[model samples]
Target: MLVPKRNWLQQAGFLTGLYGQYLKVYLKTLVEYRADTLIALVAGIVAQGSTLLFLTVIFQKIPKLADWSFYELVFLFGLAATGKSINQAFFNAPFSLTGYIRRGQMDIMMIRPVGVLLQAIGSSQELNGVGQLVTGIAIMGFAGAHLDLQWTAGTLLYVVIALLSSAVIQFAVLLTISVLTFWVQEVRSVIYPVNWLYDFTRYPLEIFHPLLRGLLTYVIPYALGSFFPAAFLLRPESYGWAMWGVPAAAVITMSLAYCLWTFGIRRYSSVAG
Candidate 1:
């Protein structure tokens, strides 16, 4: 039996390699601005930690949200924070699409031989998100020690996969929302509410009204990225399906997001045209 070899180029592997190189460049540039980077890092820490503190304060009063104990909800918040930090550090440029479009810089990107979508996504990286990463991991550790997760080997592996998949799903959704700038010209206004939706994932989705829960699960799928993963980790007997759906949802959302981004770029009317 003869099997055809996989075509790496056909799968955009080369473009991803270029994206990695761009990330290296972005990191270098970020390091070059040491003072600003320090300030940004501190600001990111304060901003993300303040949100966590706020959640903790609220949970202190209520003790739980829809059956999720405080420590369990901390795990959920950490999962969402990890995804957000990873996206910010890796694909922040895609979320800044409006600025490029407004300045007519996209034509330069379009002229490059590489894939424009990859170029756009890897154009910038928020090195400051290191703080958020630290905060998230710290919170996860705290919850693990306090929440009685009783994690077996398999469960621990599932948690790692679920967190990674959640990050991929988050990045995909942000990319899809940001890519709309190609047609909309300016998307800053829309991005605010979108940010709020992403922020919502930081809490237990079960706390939402049934209608909103159904909408998130069936339509937005944000719950899959944060709430479901947490529910699986903290209450596996009840939310067992999330152990499977985390990767499944990530694959589906990321595949669709890439397709839309490619289609959008194909429709791009360069600034000159």
Candidate 2:
């Protein structure tokens, strides 16, 4: 047992070191476009903030949306923002994979010793994700003060779990969509629906039709990624099931995404050099 444990630890450390090198290279490349990167960062912050401003305008006439007050909605939006920021910062490289495939760059990835999927994901880095992260932190802080909930050790642990799960779900979803481009070769049209997912986080699941709510919760699983986590954190007594659902749904979606990506790559038929 101890021998197996030691081997597992060694493998974990090796993988961590490999990922660290990938990250280091990305950070270096990000700084290479300092000026343009700054402009993009500012634009991303304003774009995300403007969405929240619109939400505020709509909610002014309606005090509660399915029993969710303005601050509660803010908390949900913060969770969604933080989850998206995490995806943008870490997993968004996969978003470019489709372009690489169409441009025949993916052939080079297959010859590399590193995992091809991981290599494809690490090809491009976005420094602008940092701006989204900063805004996410600000939103969470505002939600904390306005929502006003008593925190405990267990609740803190759950909050961390929720954040992690939310990130995983969003990352998996994005990856799955990107991988689809291997077959479709044109996914720009679907991007609008992807953007619309953010709307789901603004209100509680209860606000949607029962069938649509079930579809989001059980099929696409977006509810688990943001709404359920926010619901649990902001109203633990009323939504305790989310404590289990958030992490469970994330794990399920990740496993499925990994399988889909693997299958998609195996089906890949790139041209010869």
List all candidate RMSDs to the true structure.
4.3, 4.0
Model 2 ranges off by over 4 Å: 1-8, 29-32
lDDT of 2 at 199: 60
Which portions of model 1 miss their true places by more than 4 Å?
1-6, 9-13, 150-153
Candidate 2 displacement at residue 22 in angstroms: 2.3
Candidate 1's residue-wise lDDT over 1-273, tens digit each? 453354877556766676779878977877898887777678767876787788779877986677777777778888788777777777676667777776777888877665666766787677777768777777788888998777689877987787778778777877788888878866767666665677777777766788888867777777888888887788779888887888999999999989998898788887767
lDDT of 1 at 27: 72
Candidate 2, number of clashes: 0
lDDT (tens digit, per residue) of candidate 2 on 194-249: 74675676568887789888877777677788888888888778888998988998
What is residue 84's positional error in candidate 1, in angstroms? 1.3
Cα deviation in Å at residue 68, candidate 2?
Answer: 1.2
Q: What is the Cα-based lDDT of residue 209 in candidate 1?
A: 84
